[model samples]
Target: MSEQRTVPETETETDTETPEVVAPEVVAPEAADAAAAGLPAPPGGSGRSRRVLAAVARWTAAVLVFGGVGAGTAAGITAMERTEVPGLATESDGRWEYPRLSLPALPQGSPRPFTDGNEGEIHHADLRALLLPAPAGAAVDPKANGGWTTRDAFLSAYGKEDRPPLARALDDSTLRHIAVRAWTMPDGTRSSVHLLRFGSVGYAEEFKDALIASEGGGVVPDILPEGAAGAKMETYGDDIDVPDTRPYIYQEPKPYGPEQIRWAYIQAGDTLAVVRQSRKGEAAHVPFQQTVTLQNQLLG
Candidate 1:
């Protein structure tokens, strides 16, 4: 009986020592928290350990919320940029359909409304809608104008068989497209603007040189009738104060009639334009004014 009681006491002591050894592991988490807080671990560090765990949870949640918000904002911006809007997106063929351009107001009133085609004439099968350039606040009346592509047709309308300068300008090597617009002035006289869009700038320059050389003394005739009289052509160099101004040729109506008319031709980029301003009374510099304004529009 004494030997059995001594064995039971030894077993009890072993069990007690085992718990003491394992007790330190339970407190290990508390000790780590104290160290992280820059404080010496206390004998009982459970409170500090709970505080550290709570702080870590809050920081992690805050990081996730902010990160998610930032990512969502970035995604929204990307979507907006990719969205298609008129004038913002290009076609598959790489053409940007620009918005209707604002033009300068006419002298009589606001510009005439836009039209699909001019009256009394037809566009070529390949001819697209006219994309005219005009100064801001000025108005354009496309319906009031008519255009023809063939050289012979153009001459027939103008009542002229041939003019050397204009014929050279119509050569296929230099000319790519020829269109004209005829608008009625406020005074009932008719005015016309010609658009000669060339295939290349080199061709345009060549056409300009030919026209300038043909009209001796830098004069452009308002009308090139076979038997015209009193044709007064004026050549302007640096004296004309205009933006992107090139050498300009102005021709007053021949015979010095009561009807006032002025004609001019100027080049902007790949287009060489002819502008004729006509009225029943005294002559005005309307053609020159339009030329300068149109050039500014082109530059823009």
Candidate 2:
């Protein structure tokens, strides 16, 4: 097991830097009316609130733009309050409401994995903090509720036949730690996220390669999840473009027993993330894609 510590809540500091404000083209008549009515204005028009929103919008755009440039760029973006942003504020598109995510504080003098002076690309923060938090209204699994878990617990996700080989591989891969989080949504969609950290980038890559390799030109992993016998490559249209990370997404073909499963493997630096979602009848693609994308962003 890896060392465990309490992850401190990130403190919000007011940005003192002044932003170069751009004038809006259209000022809604409702802005003044809304203000006079003691309600907030629509997310436009010229005012202190609009300026703040504009600044946040620009900052969010920069984060998304820089995300593809290199590793660690997305770390700063996850700290922003999602509800404060306009489009992201609501879950109207079948997206779950996840809490504001922030990278855990590193030990003094420790450089970030992709930053200068850190060649190993090792995460210096607690693994537990890297696991995505359960979304609103989710019934969290008490067994794997964002904490360090044993190797056996991690391997249990695989079929019984595949678990032995995976266990052996994990033993030889210089695996350092494993952290997990799991929850069931109101609609019966069960989701779990597992993060495996290795001693170095080479070991992590080797493990990921071994796990994903298949006999034919198949995108599915060699070892399927507990109940899934087979899966086919699934495209959510929008791909996550974070640097130093790759995602392999697949969905269990129809005629599955009971529930359909969608899973993805995210190989990021010295860590590999496995995200799995299963639902009876059918698992919606939008939420699965949204979940995987957010998790990949955090790992980026």
Candidate 3:
């Protein structure tokens, strides 16, 4: 698998600007009866205090949901203490495991709609995981105004040429519902891949449009994601370009897995590349060469 980049893969990795302080959280006052009843607080707060209250409220709700005695919202906490993830329970040494993605990469723009073995193996239903710290250069832009991701950065990572590869190969007619799972590394590095039912570029375009709008704060996250009420996202490039279907496209934020995972769409190769980064621990970053090699083997 030879990943001969028509474009020279940069020797340096992207680093992050220091994050701006999130406004201090403010917890709206709860009614005394509600407090006494121990009903969960309505989660609207300004800064850090709001965060603390929200956490407490979630624990209380979890307890109630899990039905723990002396338990209020804390049931979730207790359950989590006793519970174990199916695979995460095993704490092997720092080894990287590529988890199969749950979705297929929309590649209408690529020479190959799916991936070829020589260029890079298509990572549909697979993911790469590691315990390593984020690569030295990855960091979230503090001034991105709490943006989801930056466009210049994404282009730097995914590039315009890559976008065409996907556009060229994917079958717009086959697309059904397209879903995306994205993750932001604590160090500010981010990654994501769009999932779709083959040939359904409509969903893909709709998603891209939604992302462009949301990234600019022209739209809000809660308006679309009935599931996610408050989190916000940001974008980095020119508005998503999907013509013939809709003149405009904007992306709505999506949720995948648990924990604060930051995700976004970046055209990596013949397929959409999905990258996940954790906020607290080091994100496992494969050397650019390794990533290219893997992609070429999978896609070539």
Which lDDT values do the candidates have, in the order given? 0.48, 0.78, 0.34
- Candidate whose TM-score is highest: 2
- Error (Å) of candidate 3 at residue 12 is 32
After superposition of all CA atoms, the RMSD between model 1 and the true structure is 27.3
lDDT of 2 at 66: 56
If scored against the real structure, what TM-score would every candidate get? Answer: 0.43, 0.67, 0.24
**TM-score-based ranking:** 2, 1, 3
lDDT, candidate 1, 1-300, per-residue tens: 000001011111122121111111233566779989999986864677767766666667667766877787678656753323223443342111223444333335322222233221121222223424332233345653445456554544343434544665567435667776554534355556666666654666566665565633322434443322344567554344334335455555546666766666665545566666666665456334534344335322
Candidate 2 lDDT over 1-300, as tens digits, reads: 011111223344454443344434444568878988999986665478657766677677666645544344355457666654334554345677777777789899887777777777898888888898888889999998999999998888888878877887888889999999999999999999999999987888778877777523322356668887688766554466567778888899978888999999888889999999999999988678878887887777
Candidate 3 wrong stretches, greater than 4 Å? 1-111, 114-194, 198-203, 214-262, 267-274, 287-300
RMSD of each: 27.3, 18.9, 26.6
Highest lDDT model number? 2
Give residue 137's lDDT in candidate 1 (0 to 100).
30
